[model samples]
Target: MTREELIKNIKSKQSFLCVGLDSDIKKLPAHLLSEPNSIFAFNKAIIDATAPYAVAYKPNMAFYESLGAQGWTALEETVSYIQNNYPDQFIIADAKRGDIGNTSTLYARSFFEHLGVDAITVAPYMGQDSVSPFLGYDSKWVVLLSLTSNKGSHDFQLTEDKNGKRLFENVIETSQQWASDKEMMYVVGATQGKMFADIRKIAP
Candidate 1:
């Protein structure tokens, strides 16, 4: 979805809620376990229930990937269901995937062409080449990892260079040269708090 469409949806719905479908098989309700595809079944129910209040749905890849082929199938079905039934709602594959250029190209095709998600999370540590491939598709987004909420984020993201610029600050500033706000977004954690003030100064 384009940034305009997403913003319009948020206005029409009066909510910018993006629900995360991080459904784990082990955590599913006992009754859903008997379904032919329990993960998809659980996701379908959640989507139907939350679609009214949400403008987007994010499906975390790890939960499905761990299930192997069956999980992949479930992930596909869940995406298809949302596309068919909740066409206006944006879909994000919360797959923090980033690799070499060739591999990133395949990953881009897999998510943008095959699975057909609106966006996918990407790790920017591999630098621009690892992320540039994903930017080739129009309206498809590369949600680059920036300041994460995890404690370990400080291990790298907050590190300062000789010039005293923080790593996450550099990630946001440098990445802007590659794509406009329409096609790219930074994963600024809510826990980052005042750090968002710094991000806005550079990115806004």
Candidate 2:
């Protein structure tokens, strides 16, 4: 959706909450496992219950990808359900995909064309070309993994360079040139706490 539309939703609902639907079949409700479309059933229930509070939903790709075809089918159904039932809610494919040019283009099409999510989490390790292909689609976005919440994030993201800028800072600074804020966002790890204030000044 366009930035204005997203803003209008947030203003109307007075919420910016994006629920993560990282549902695992093994951990789903005991009864849902027996349903013909167990994953989708559970997801539909989740969206129904949380719909009032959430403005977005993120379905982590690994959970569905692990089940192969069945998982993929469930994922597509989940996206369709959201689009039909709650058209205003933003959907993010938390796939964290990163690859070379041609492959990245295919990946973008798979998510934007096939699965139909509003955006996808992309690993920026492969740089601009990897993320830019996804931006080719109108009103779609690429959420670049910058300062992650994991402990390993400090290993590289916080490392100081010759110019004394931390790696994460550089990622935020350099990435803006690749796409405008309307088509791009940086993932500032939730664990960053106060650090988000800094990242916002750079990106916001």
Candidate 3:
């Protein structure tokens, strides 16, 4: 979806809610275990239940991928289901991928082309080339990992630069040069609270 379409969704729905389909097979309801394509079945239920309030669906790649080939097929089917049924809702693959040039390109193609998510969460630790491949797709987005909600986020993201700018701030500033706000978004955790104020200073 384009930036305008996403904005339109937010306005019409009056919500910016994003549903995360972190469906772990082990935690699924007992009855669902007996179903064929259990992963997709669980995701479809969640989507149907939450679609009214959510503007986007983000499927955590690791959870689905851990189950192997069948898991991957389920992920594809889940994405296609949303695409066909909710064309205006944005889809994000929470892959958090970052590697060298070639590896990144393949990842970009896998998520943005074949699997067909409108966006992918990416790790920027590998720098420009690692993240740029995702930016080349039209109307696609790169949700760069910045200040996370994890306990250890204070370790690196908080490091102060010579000019006293936080590492994540520098990341936000420099990366903004790579793409417009519509194509790029930083992952700012709600637990960060006031820190989001700081993020807006750079990202706004």
Candidate 3 C-alpha RMSD relative to the actual structure: 0.8
When 1 and 2 are scored with lDDT, the better candidate is 1
* Best model number under lDDT: 1
Candidate 1, residues 1-204: lDDT per residue as tens digits?
Answer: 999999999999999799999999999999999999999999999999999999999999999999999999999999999999999999999999989778999999999999999999999998999899999698999999999999999999999999999999999999999999999998988889889789989988
Per-residue C-alpha lDDT of model 3 across residues 173-197, encoded as one tens digit per residue:
8899899988998898788888987
Q: What's the CA RMSD for each of the models?
A: 0.8, 0.9, 0.8
Model 3 is weakest, by summed lDDT over 10 consecutive residues, at: 195-204
Off by over 4 Å in 1: none
Where is model 2 more than 4 Å wrong at Cα?
A: none
Least well predicted 10-residue stretch by lDDT in candidate 2: 127-136
Poorest 10 consecutive residues of model 1 by lDDT?
188-197
Clashing pairs for predicted structure model 1, backbone only: none
